[model samples]
Target: MMRARTRKLIGTVALIIFLGVYAWVAAVIGAGRISLAPAWAQFAYFLAAGLLWVLPAGLLIRWMQRAD
Candidate 1:
């Protein structure tokens, strides 16, 4: 069961990283010189999506370490 859970977690983290990269690209292209959105919006978008993967990865890593 632990092995299965770890595999699923890896898949989930990979998906999140993919989505984060896509979102970063979209944000950069959508914001133009005359755009109202702050330049930081791109960074924020990337960060928020990246954290989705990071938080769970951290938790799972911690759990696995403890399990050892």
Candidate 2:
């Protein structure tokens, strides 16, 4: 079992990596596929993608807080 501090550090690192990849993918998809959508649809997709990173982050945070 990891110490709380260690868990937090690992979680933070994981979160950073996850966010970087997530943003890159989102940007690529937004630039490629999303660019083909109508303006309103593109707006909606961008909005959804913007908020989508939070769910996995929340899960990671929850795990980081778990009792050892």
Top candidate, metric lDDT: 2
Question: For model 2, what is the alpha-carbon lDDT of residue 35?
Answer: 100
lDDT of 1 at 59: 67
Worst 10 residues of 1 by lDDT: 29-38
Q: Considering every candidate listed, which one attains the maximal TM-score?
A: 2
RMSD of each: 5.6, 1.1
**Model 1 agreement with the true structure over 1-68: per-residue lDDT tens digits:** 46756756775676578667866765675565325556697667556755665666666556655442
Cα deviation at 45, candidate 2, in Å, is: 0.7
Model 2, range 1-68, lDDT digits (tens) per residue?
A: 68989999999999999999999999999999889999999999999999999999999999999988
Query: Local distance difference test, per candidate?
Result: 0.62, 0.96
Q: How do all models score by TM-score?
A: 0.38, 0.90
Model 2, which residues run further than 4 Å from truth?
Answer: none
Give the C-alpha miss distance for residue 1 in model 2, angstroms. 1.6
lDDT of 1 at 67: 42
